[model samples]
Target: MRSYPVDSPHAAGRILALTMIVDGNLVGSELAALSRSKILDHIDLDHADFQHLLKDLCEDLLTSTSHGAIQVDNALIDSVLEEIVHPDLRRSLLHAMWSIADADGWLADAEAVLLTRASNAWAAETNFSSPSYRRP
Candidate 1:
């Protein structure tokens, strides 16, 4: 998979893209939820750029799935999550991911695993001493 610079908008968009496809299908509701979240604006990524990032992610996944199986293990996830070191960006991405996961009204096992992994990883990396720090 192509790697973006740490904390770059493309890196952030990649994580969001993974969230959209991890469940094996990208539904309309998930896209709608992403649009409503306005996370792209926060990350300084426009819709067009985000779409490009999504396409890149899909291509990478497809290329890696030569055996007819897509392997998205925790180590791969950690590598992606490691790109976003900013606490605020991590929080925003996490919230957007949750919104997308729940948008279809049924959270699949893959979605739950991704969400939990991201939340736990980010939580451990961030200092939660501030009173304003809240898990999204």
Candidate 2:
């Protein structure tokens, strides 16, 4: 599993976000519920799981990025960055940021900056090495 030291700057917010994404998919609630719960009421992490699609999205991004272990398909990172490439996945990322920013349930200035930076970074990475769509 990709390991970012807990001491790394902003690591907790990022990891917490990822965890919520992976588990939230099953937990069927929100990031808050996903984090503080165990044994989701009715869900499974394996057996025709979400990883297949999640992996490709991450590999494609990482193949073009220097984000490395901190953002690769490392099981931990997969929980979040796996969806970095999909427009549909933004919800979870946004929600996670919302969670982080609103630990007090109210967005803060720095948290807004963090969310904006993360969103831009993820979006920018997607375009860096992507081949332009061209009918061949």
Candidate 3:
């Protein structure tokens, strides 16, 4: 078995592709923030590399995040989200989460909270729904 570098830039396209799946209500600033936030947290995430990883990641996530009610129900949706965030992809997800939260390089309290909830949820063994922050 060959172990891959966790911070390898090869996955950049994949990240963007996955993120592109989720349509609507994603403020462009937010999405751009998300991408940037993820890279910032991972010291090795070069801005140039992200451009590449995004394509495949978005490709992986396209159908799953397709337009819909911001689904908080349905086992299938959860499963799909979980599948989309598979362990390998989870790194990218975490990276993306940080990217969103840290995009501006100033961590707002709310964004910090959001990052904790998401990264923690994604890191769980059984993949429990990420703890939520009440809607503002």
- Give the per-residue lDDT digits (tens) of candidate 2, residues 26-56: 2334434444332122222331232443354
Per-candidate TM equals 0.92, 0.31, 0.35
lDDT per residue for candidate 1 within 45-135, as digits (tens), equals 9999989999989888888874799988778888898999999888899999999999999999988989998988898888634878687
How do these models rank on lDDT, best leading?
1, 3, 2
Q: 8-64 in candidate 3: lDDT tens per residue?
A: 444333333333333323346755765445543454556555554554444444445
Model 2 worst lDDT run, 10 consecutive residues: 39-48
Candidate 2 clashing pairs, residues 3+ apart or interchain: 102-105
Off by over 4 Å in 2: 1-14, 17-91, 127-136
Candidate 1, position 76, lDDT = 82
lDDT of 2: 0.40
Q: Judging by TM-score, tell me the better candidate of 1 and 2.
A: 1
The reply for model 1, stretches above 4 Å from the true place, is 129-136
Better of 2 and 3 by lDDT: 3
Indicate the residue-level lDDT of 43 in model 1.
93
Top candidate (TM-score): 1
